[model samples]
Target: MRKFLASIAVSLLITGCTFPGVHKIDIPQGNVVTQEMVDQLKPGMTRNQVRYIMGTPLVTDTFSPDRWDYIYSQQKGGEERTQKNLSLFFSDNSLQRISGDYRPGGAAQ
Candidate 1:
Protein backbone atom coordinates (compact mmCIF):
# COMPACT_ATOMS: atom_id res chain seq x y z
CA MET A 1 0.00 0.00 0.00
CA ARG A 2 2.84 2.37 0.91
CA LYS A 3 4.70 1.66 -2.35
CA PHE A 4 1.57 2.27 -4.41
CA LEU A 5 0.98 5.58 -2.63
CA ALA A 6 4.58 6.64 -3.17
CA SER A 7 4.31 5.85 -6.88
CA ILE A 8 1.11 7.88 -7.19
CA ALA A 9 2.76 10.84 -5.45
CA VAL A 10 5.76 10.68 -7.76
CA SER A 11 3.55 10.57 -10.84
CA LEU A 12 1.56 13.55 -9.66
CA LEU A 13 4.69 15.54 -8.93
CA ILE A 14 6.12 14.81 -12.36
CA THR A 15 2.89 15.76 -14.08
CA GLY A 16 2.65 19.01 -12.15
CA CYS A 17 6.14 20.16 -13.11
CA THR A 18 6.03 22.49 -16.12
CA PHE A 19 9.13 23.55 -18.04
CA PRO A 20 9.24 27.22 -18.95
CA GLY A 21 10.12 27.90 -22.60
CA VAL A 22 8.86 29.25 -25.85
CA HIS A 23 8.31 27.10 -28.91
CA LYS A 24 7.50 28.11 -32.48
CA ILE A 25 5.86 25.74 -34.93
CA ASP A 26 5.37 25.80 -38.69
CA ILE A 27 2.35 24.11 -40.25
CA PRO A 28 2.42 23.14 -43.90
CA GLN A 29 -0.54 22.49 -46.21
CA GLY A 30 -1.18 22.07 -49.92
CA ASN A 31 -0.38 25.47 -51.48
CA VAL A 32 -0.85 24.84 -55.16
CA VAL A 33 0.49 27.29 -57.77
CA THR A 34 -1.72 27.56 -60.78
CA GLN A 35 -0.45 26.85 -64.30
CA GLU A 36 -1.98 30.10 -65.54
CA MET A 37 0.69 31.99 -63.60
CA VAL A 38 3.48 30.28 -65.50
CA ASP A 39 1.79 30.78 -68.84
CA GLN A 40 1.71 34.52 -68.30
CA LEU A 41 5.49 34.64 -68.25
CA LYS A 42 7.03 35.89 -71.50
CA PRO A 43 10.45 35.72 -73.08
CA GLY A 44 12.81 38.74 -72.85
CA MET A 45 11.60 39.34 -69.29
CA THR A 46 14.42 40.07 -66.85
CA ARG A 47 15.00 38.07 -63.70
CA ASN A 48 13.42 40.72 -61.50
CA GLN A 49 10.44 40.93 -63.85
CA VAL A 50 9.94 37.17 -63.71
CA ARG A 51 10.09 37.18 -59.95
CA TYR A 52 7.57 39.99 -59.78
CA ILE A 53 5.12 37.90 -61.76
CA MET A 54 5.83 34.38 -60.47
CA GLY A 55 7.22 35.13 -57.05
CA THR A 56 10.59 33.36 -56.59
CA PRO A 57 11.76 30.20 -58.24
CA LEU A 58 12.24 27.51 -55.58
CA VAL A 59 15.46 26.11 -57.02
CA THR A 60 18.17 27.80 -59.10
CA ASP A 61 20.31 25.32 -61.05
CA THR A 62 23.91 25.99 -60.08
CA PHE A 63 25.35 23.77 -62.78
CA SER A 64 24.03 25.87 -65.64
CA PRO A 65 23.89 29.53 -66.50
CA ASP A 66 20.59 31.33 -67.23
CA ARG A 67 18.62 28.40 -65.75
CA TRP A 68 16.16 28.45 -62.85
CA ASP A 69 13.93 25.78 -61.31
CA TYR A 70 10.65 26.25 -59.51
CA ILE A 71 9.26 23.55 -57.26
CA TYR A 72 6.16 23.29 -55.09
CA SER A 73 5.05 20.31 -53.00
CA GLN A 74 2.51 19.41 -50.35
CA GLN A 75 1.92 16.29 -48.26
CA LYS A 76 -0.58 15.59 -45.50
CA GLY A 77 1.11 14.67 -42.21
CA GLY A 78 2.37 11.15 -42.96
CA GLU A 79 1.42 9.17 -46.02
CA GLU A 80 3.52 7.74 -48.83
CA ARG A 81 1.44 9.49 -51.48
CA THR A 82 3.26 11.41 -54.22
CA GLN A 83 3.80 15.14 -53.70
CA LYS A 84 3.51 17.87 -56.35
CA ASN A 85 6.62 19.57 -57.80
CA LEU A 86 7.20 22.01 -60.66
CA SER A 87 10.42 22.87 -62.50
CA LEU A 88 11.11 25.69 -64.95
CA PHE A 89 14.25 26.53 -66.89
CA PHE A 90 15.34 29.84 -68.32
CA SER A 91 17.93 30.72 -70.97
CA ASP A 92 18.94 33.98 -72.64
CA ASN A 93 16.75 35.81 -70.12
CA SER A 94 13.68 33.85 -71.17
CA LEU A 95 11.91 30.65 -70.18
CA GLN A 96 13.58 27.82 -72.06
CA ARG A 97 12.67 24.51 -70.41
CA ILE A 98 10.07 23.25 -68.01
CA SER A 99 9.59 19.77 -66.53
CA GLY A 100 8.48 18.29 -63.27
CA ASP A 101 5.98 16.22 -61.27
CA TYR A 102 3.28 18.92 -61.35
CA ARG A 103 1.42 20.17 -64.37
CA PRO A 104 2.98 23.20 -66.06
CA GLY A 105 0.68 26.16 -66.34
CA GLY A 106 -0.15 26.36 -70.04
CA ALA A 107 -0.58 29.45 -72.18
CA ALA A 108 -4.26 28.61 -72.71
CA GLN A 109 -6.37 27.62 -69.75
Candidate 2:
Protein backbone atom coordinates (compact mmCIF):
# COMPACT_ATOMS: atom_id res chain seq x y z
CA MET A 1 0.00 0.00 0.00
CA ARG A 2 2.85 2.44 0.80
CA LYS A 3 4.54 1.57 -2.51
CA PHE A 4 1.31 2.29 -4.41
CA LEU A 5 0.87 5.69 -2.69
CA ALA A 6 4.46 6.75 -3.43
CA SER A 7 4.11 5.81 -7.09
CA ILE A 8 0.86 7.78 -7.36
CA ALA A 9 2.42 10.87 -5.82
CA VAL A 10 5.38 10.69 -8.20
CA SER A 11 3.08 10.33 -11.18
CA LEU A 12 1.05 13.39 -10.13
CA LEU A 13 4.18 15.52 -9.86
CA ILE A 14 5.44 14.41 -13.26
CA THR A 15 2.09 15.13 -14.89
CA GLY A 16 1.86 18.55 -13.32
CA CYS A 17 5.28 19.49 -14.70
CA THR A 18 4.25 18.54 -18.21
CA PHE A 19 0.96 20.46 -18.07
CA PRO A 20 0.74 24.16 -19.07
CA GLY A 21 -0.51 25.28 -15.67
CA VAL A 22 1.79 28.30 -15.51
CA HIS A 23 0.30 31.64 -16.61
CA LYS A 24 2.50 33.92 -18.71
CA ILE A 25 1.37 37.51 -18.51
CA ASP A 26 1.47 39.90 -21.43
CA ILE A 27 4.72 41.88 -21.76
CA PRO A 28 4.98 45.34 -23.33
CA GLN A 29 8.12 47.37 -23.85
CA GLY A 30 9.31 50.70 -25.32
CA ASN A 31 7.70 54.00 -26.22
CA VAL A 32 4.15 54.03 -27.64
CA VAL A 33 3.80 56.14 -30.82
CA THR A 34 0.49 57.05 -32.44
CA GLN A 35 -0.64 58.61 -35.75
CA GLU A 36 -2.17 61.61 -34.06
CA MET A 37 1.15 62.25 -32.42
CA VAL A 38 2.97 62.07 -35.71
CA ASP A 39 0.45 64.38 -37.32
CA GLN A 40 1.40 66.95 -34.75
CA LEU A 41 4.86 66.92 -36.29
CA LYS A 42 5.75 69.51 -38.88
CA PRO A 43 8.71 70.20 -41.06
CA GLY A 44 11.58 72.17 -39.49
CA MET A 45 10.21 71.71 -35.98
CA THR A 46 12.87 71.92 -33.28
CA ARG A 47 14.06 68.87 -31.40
CA ASN A 48 12.32 69.98 -28.26
CA GLN A 49 8.99 70.35 -30.10
CA VAL A 50 9.31 66.92 -31.69
CA ARG A 51 10.19 65.38 -28.34
CA TYR A 52 7.17 67.07 -26.79
CA ILE A 53 4.85 65.56 -29.38
CA MET A 54 6.35 62.11 -29.75
CA GLY A 55 7.70 61.68 -26.23
CA THR A 56 11.23 60.34 -25.64
CA PRO A 57 12.63 57.95 -28.21
CA LEU A 58 13.53 54.36 -27.36
CA VAL A 59 17.00 54.53 -28.91
CA THR A 60 19.34 57.42 -29.64
CA ASP A 61 22.47 56.42 -31.43
CA THR A 62 25.71 58.27 -30.69
CA PHE A 63 26.95 57.47 -34.19
CA SER A 64 23.92 59.15 -35.70
CA PRO A 65 23.00 62.12 -33.59
CA ASP A 66 20.66 63.37 -36.33
CA ARG A 67 18.43 60.30 -36.07
CA TRP A 68 16.11 59.05 -33.33
CA ASP A 69 14.34 55.70 -33.20
CA TYR A 70 11.02 55.02 -31.49
CA ILE A 71 10.23 51.36 -31.13
CA TYR A 72 7.36 49.54 -29.41
CA SER A 73 6.78 45.83 -28.89
CA GLN A 74 4.41 43.52 -27.03
CA GLN A 75 4.15 39.78 -26.41
CA LYS A 76 0.79 38.36 -25.39
CA GLY A 77 1.43 35.42 -23.12
CA GLY A 78 2.78 32.56 -25.25
CA GLU A 79 2.12 34.23 -28.59
CA GLU A 80 4.68 35.87 -30.89
CA ARG A 81 5.82 39.43 -30.35
CA THR A 82 4.28 42.31 -32.32
CA GLN A 83 6.45 45.35 -32.92
CA LYS A 84 6.22 48.90 -34.35
CA ASN A 85 9.13 51.07 -35.38
CA LEU A 86 9.39 54.77 -36.23
CA SER A 87 12.38 56.91 -37.10
CA LEU A 88 12.76 60.67 -37.01
CA PHE A 89 15.38 62.31 -39.14
CA PHE A 90 16.70 65.72 -38.34
CA SER A 91 18.58 68.29 -40.39
CA ASP A 92 20.32 71.15 -38.56
CA ASN A 93 18.69 70.22 -35.27
CA SER A 94 15.22 70.40 -36.82
CA LEU A 95 12.82 67.60 -37.65
CA GLN A 96 12.91 66.85 -41.39
CA ARG A 97 10.89 63.68 -41.95
CA ILE A 98 9.29 60.72 -40.25
CA SER A 99 9.10 57.11 -41.41
CA GLY A 100 8.02 53.76 -40.03
CA ASP A 101 5.19 51.24 -39.54
CA TYR A 102 2.77 54.17 -39.23
CA ARG A 103 2.15 57.31 -41.31
CA PRO A 104 1.11 60.73 -40.14
CA GLY A 105 -2.66 61.23 -39.94
CA GLY A 106 -4.62 59.17 -42.53
CA ALA A 107 -1.68 58.83 -44.90
CA ALA A 108 -1.64 55.04 -44.57
CA GLN A 109 -4.80 54.18 -42.89
Candidate 3:
Protein backbone atom coordinates (compact mmCIF):
# COMPACT_ATOMS: atom_id res chain seq x y z
CA MET A 1 0.00 0.00 0.00
CA ARG A 2 2.86 2.40 0.88
CA LYS A 3 4.75 1.68 -2.37
CA PHE A 4 1.57 2.21 -4.47
CA LEU A 5 0.89 5.59 -2.75
CA ALA A 6 4.51 6.72 -3.21
CA SER A 7 4.43 5.77 -6.93
CA ILE A 8 1.14 7.68 -7.43
CA ALA A 9 2.61 10.79 -5.70
CA VAL A 10 5.76 10.63 -7.90
CA SER A 11 3.67 10.35 -11.04
CA LEU A 12 1.56 13.32 -9.99
CA LEU A 13 4.70 15.38 -9.31
CA ILE A 14 6.15 14.57 -12.76
CA THR A 15 2.94 15.47 -14.50
CA GLY A 16 2.71 18.72 -12.54
CA CYS A 17 6.22 19.69 -13.61
CA THR A 18 5.33 19.34 -17.30
CA PHE A 19 3.75 22.26 -19.07
CA PRO A 20 1.35 22.21 -21.98
CA GLY A 21 2.46 24.23 -24.98
CA VAL A 22 0.65 27.47 -25.73
CA HIS A 23 -1.28 27.94 -28.96
CA LYS A 24 -1.25 31.28 -30.80
CA ILE A 25 -3.53 32.29 -33.64
CA ASP A 26 -2.27 34.08 -36.73
CA ILE A 27 -3.17 37.80 -36.95
CA PRO A 28 -3.81 39.60 -40.22
CA GLN A 29 -4.73 43.23 -40.75
CA GLY A 30 -5.57 45.72 -43.57
CA ASN A 31 -6.02 45.07 -47.28
CA VAL A 32 -4.28 41.90 -48.49
CA VAL A 33 -3.33 42.92 -52.03
CA THR A 34 -1.32 40.45 -54.11
CA GLN A 35 1.22 41.12 -56.86
CA GLU A 36 -1.14 39.85 -59.52
CA MET A 37 -3.64 42.56 -58.62
CA VAL A 38 -1.06 45.32 -58.92
CA ASP A 39 0.08 43.93 -62.24
CA GLN A 40 -3.39 44.59 -63.65
CA LEU A 41 -3.16 48.32 -63.00
CA LYS A 42 -2.60 50.60 -66.03
CA PRO A 43 -1.66 54.28 -66.05
CA GLY A 44 -4.88 55.50 -67.60
CA MET A 45 -7.30 53.33 -65.63
CA THR A 46 -10.10 55.17 -63.87
CA ARG A 47 -10.58 55.22 -60.11
CA ASN A 48 -13.44 52.77 -60.42
CA GLN A 49 -11.31 50.42 -62.45
CA VAL A 50 -8.50 50.58 -59.93
CA ARG A 51 -10.95 49.86 -57.14
CA TYR A 52 -12.28 46.87 -59.05
CA ILE A 53 -8.76 45.51 -59.40
CA MET A 54 -7.24 46.31 -56.00
CA GLY A 55 -10.29 46.85 -53.83
CA THR A 56 -10.67 50.08 -51.82
CA PRO A 57 -7.59 51.84 -50.56
CA LEU A 58 -6.75 51.23 -46.91
CA VAL A 59 -5.80 54.84 -46.36
CA THR A 60 -7.48 57.65 -48.29
CA ASP A 61 -6.83 61.25 -47.38
CA THR A 62 -9.60 63.81 -47.76
CA PHE A 63 -6.96 66.44 -48.33
CA SER A 64 -5.28 64.33 -51.01
CA PRO A 65 -7.98 62.75 -53.11
CA ASP A 66 -5.54 62.12 -55.93
CA ARG A 67 -3.48 59.66 -53.89
CA TRP A 68 -4.61 56.21 -52.79
CA ASP A 69 -2.59 54.11 -50.35
CA TYR A 70 -2.91 50.34 -50.08
CA ILE A 71 -1.29 48.58 -47.17
CA TYR A 72 -1.07 44.95 -46.04
CA SER A 73 0.44 43.26 -42.98
CA GLN A 74 0.35 39.87 -41.30
CA GLN A 75 1.92 38.17 -38.31
CA LYS A 76 1.98 34.40 -37.86
CA GLY A 77 2.78 32.64 -34.64
CA GLY A 78 6.57 32.27 -34.15
CA GLU A 79 7.20 33.49 -37.71
CA GLU A 80 8.54 36.65 -39.32
CA ARG A 81 6.05 39.46 -39.98
CA THR A 82 5.20 40.55 -43.53
CA GLN A 83 4.17 43.98 -44.86
CA LYS A 84 3.60 45.70 -48.21
CA ASN A 85 2.57 49.22 -49.22
CA LEU A 86 1.45 50.54 -52.58
CA SER A 87 0.52 54.09 -53.47
CA LEU A 88 -1.25 55.25 -56.62
CA PHE A 89 -1.17 58.79 -57.88
CA PHE A 90 -3.98 60.14 -60.01
CA SER A 91 -4.62 63.19 -62.15
CA ASP A 92 -8.17 64.11 -63.21
CA ASN A 93 -9.46 60.83 -61.64
CA SER A 94 -7.19 58.60 -63.70
CA LEU A 95 -4.37 56.50 -62.31
CA GLN A 96 -1.08 58.19 -63.30
CA ARG A 97 1.69 56.51 -61.26
CA ILE A 98 2.39 53.59 -58.95
CA SER A 99 4.86 53.75 -56.07
CA GLY A 100 5.89 52.25 -52.72
CA ASP A 101 7.17 48.79 -51.80
CA TYR A 102 5.72 47.09 -54.90
CA ARG A 103 6.10 48.07 -58.54
CA PRO A 104 4.74 46.28 -61.57
CA GLY A 105 6.94 44.77 -64.35
CA GLY A 106 9.95 44.88 -61.97
CA ALA A 107 10.37 48.57 -62.83
CA ALA A 108 12.23 50.83 -60.39
CA GLN A 109 11.55 54.58 -60.85
Candidate 4:
Protein backbone atom coordinates (compact mmCIF):
# COMPACT_ATOMS: atom_id res chain seq x y z
CA MET A 1 0.00 0.00 0.00
CA ARG A 2 2.83 2.41 0.80
CA LYS A 3 4.56 1.69 -2.53
CA PHE A 4 1.28 2.21 -4.38
CA LEU A 5 0.69 5.53 -2.64
CA ALA A 6 4.24 6.69 -3.45
CA SER A 7 3.79 5.86 -7.14
CA ILE A 8 0.50 7.74 -7.24
CA ALA A 9 2.05 10.79 -5.62
CA VAL A 10 4.95 10.76 -8.04
CA SER A 11 2.59 10.60 -11.01
CA LEU A 12 0.58 13.52 -9.70
CA LEU A 13 3.69 15.64 -9.26
CA ILE A 14 4.79 14.96 -12.84
CA THR A 15 1.36 15.70 -14.22
CA GLY A 16 1.10 18.91 -12.25
CA CYS A 17 4.25 20.25 -13.88
CA THR A 18 2.88 19.41 -17.34
CA PHE A 19 -0.32 21.37 -16.84
CA PRO A 20 -0.70 24.27 -19.28
CA GLY A 21 -0.98 26.88 -16.54
CA VAL A 22 2.30 25.83 -14.95
CA HIS A 23 4.70 28.74 -14.77
CA LYS A 24 8.39 28.49 -15.65
CA ILE A 25 10.72 31.19 -14.44
CA ASP A 26 13.19 32.84 -16.77
CA ILE A 27 16.51 30.92 -16.81
CA PRO A 28 19.69 32.83 -17.44
CA GLN A 29 23.10 31.17 -17.47
CA GLY A 30 26.78 31.97 -17.87
CA ASN A 31 28.51 35.31 -17.64
CA VAL A 32 26.02 38.16 -17.84
CA VAL A 33 28.19 40.34 -20.01
CA THR A 34 26.84 43.87 -20.47
CA GLN A 35 27.38 46.67 -22.97
CA GLU A 36 28.61 49.07 -20.30
CA MET A 37 31.20 46.55 -19.23
CA VAL A 38 32.46 46.12 -22.75
CA ASP A 39 32.54 49.86 -23.23
CA GLN A 40 34.64 50.25 -20.15
CA LEU A 41 37.39 48.25 -21.83
CA LYS A 42 40.01 50.24 -23.69
CA PRO A 43 42.99 49.32 -25.75
CA GLY A 44 46.22 49.04 -23.74
CA MET A 45 44.42 48.13 -20.51
CA THR A 46 46.11 45.29 -18.65
CA ARG A 47 44.50 41.86 -18.41
CA ASN A 48 43.81 42.31 -14.70
CA GLN A 49 42.14 45.65 -15.35
CA VAL A 50 39.99 44.18 -18.08
CA ARG A 51 39.00 41.34 -15.82
CA TYR A 52 37.99 43.80 -13.13
CA ILE A 53 35.80 45.82 -15.51
CA MET A 54 34.20 42.95 -17.44
CA GLY A 55 34.08 40.25 -14.78
CA THR A 56 35.53 36.81 -15.41
CA PRO A 57 35.31 35.53 -18.96
CA LEU A 58 33.09 32.54 -19.65
CA VAL A 59 35.64 30.85 -21.91
CA THR A 60 39.40 30.95 -21.88
CA ASP A 61 41.42 28.64 -24.07
CA THR A 62 44.86 27.44 -23.12
CA PHE A 63 45.78 27.04 -26.77
CA SER A 64 44.67 30.60 -27.49
CA PRO A 65 45.98 32.28 -24.39
CA ASP A 66 45.42 35.79 -25.70
CA ARG A 67 41.73 35.35 -26.45
CA TRP A 68 38.97 35.49 -23.86
CA ASP A 69 35.34 34.77 -24.70
CA TYR A 70 32.38 36.05 -22.70
CA ILE A 71 29.12 34.32 -23.46
CA TYR A 72 25.60 34.93 -22.15
CA SER A 73 22.40 32.98 -22.69
CA GLN A 74 18.79 33.32 -21.54
CA GLN A 75 15.75 31.11 -21.79
CA LYS A 76 12.34 32.66 -21.21
CA GLY A 77 9.53 30.51 -19.83
CA GLY A 78 8.06 29.57 -23.20
CA GLU A 79 10.33 31.15 -25.76
CA GLU A 80 13.40 30.16 -27.74
CA ARG A 81 16.78 30.55 -26.07
CA THR A 82 18.85 33.61 -26.98
CA GLN A 83 22.61 34.08 -26.74
CA LYS A 84 25.24 36.80 -26.93
CA ASN A 85 28.98 36.46 -27.42
CA LEU A 86 31.92 38.73 -26.79
CA SER A 87 35.57 38.10 -27.55
CA LEU A 88 38.39 40.19 -26.23
CA PHE A 89 41.90 39.85 -27.53
CA PHE A 90 44.99 40.74 -25.60
CA SER A 91 48.60 41.03 -26.68
CA ASP A 92 51.51 41.43 -24.29
CA ASN A 93 49.08 41.40 -21.37
CA SER A 94 47.28 44.47 -22.72
CA LEU A 95 43.91 44.62 -24.44
CA GLN A 96 44.21 44.85 -28.19
CA ARG A 97 40.69 44.60 -29.62
CA ILE A 98 37.12 43.52 -29.03
CA SER A 99 34.78 41.41 -31.15
CA GLY A 100 31.44 39.59 -31.24
CA ASP A 101 27.91 40.85 -30.40
CA TYR A 102 29.00 43.63 -28.05
CA ARG A 103 30.88 46.79 -28.97
CA PRO A 104 31.91 49.97 -27.22
CA GLY A 105 30.17 53.38 -27.49
CA GLY A 106 26.58 51.99 -27.85
CA ALA A 107 24.09 49.26 -27.05
CA ALA A 108 24.87 45.65 -27.70
CA GLN A 109 24.43 44.36 -31.21
- Candidate with the larger lDDT of 3 and 4: 4
| Model 1 stretches with alpha carbons more than 4 Å out | 1-32, 77-82, 102-109
Candidate 1 residue-wise lDDT, 1-109, digit = tens? 9999999989978866343443433334343456677666665677778778667766666777566665555443343444556666666677666666544455443
Number of backbone clashes in candidate 1: 1
lDDT of 1 at 96: 61
Taking all chains together, the TM-score of candidate 3 against the true structure is 0.75
Highest lDDT among the candidates is held by which one? 4
Query: For every model shown, what is its TM-score relative to the native structure?
Result: 0.52, 0.77, 0.75, 0.82
* Model 4: per-residue Cα lDDT at residue 70: 90
Q: Write the per-residue lDDT of candidate 2 for residues 20-57, one digit (tens) a residue.
A: 77777899999988778887888899999999988989
Rank by lDDT, highest first.
Answer: 4, 2, 3, 1
- On residues 1-109, what C-alpha lDDT tens digit does candidate 4 reach at each position? 9999999999998898778888989999999987888778889999999999988898999999999999999999968999999999999999999999987977644
Writing each residue's lDDT as its tens digit, candidate 3 over 1-109 gives 9999999999988876354665556889899888778888999999999999999999999999999999899989746889889999999989999998887865433
TM-score of decoy 4? 0.82
Look at candidate 2 and give me any clashing residue pairs.
Answer: none
Which pairs of residues have clashing backbones in candidate 3? none
Model number with the top TM-score: 4
For all predictions, the C-alpha RMSD in Å is 6.9, 3.2, 6.4, 3.4
Residue pairs with colliding backbones in model 1 are 35-105
Residue 64, model 4: lDDT of 100
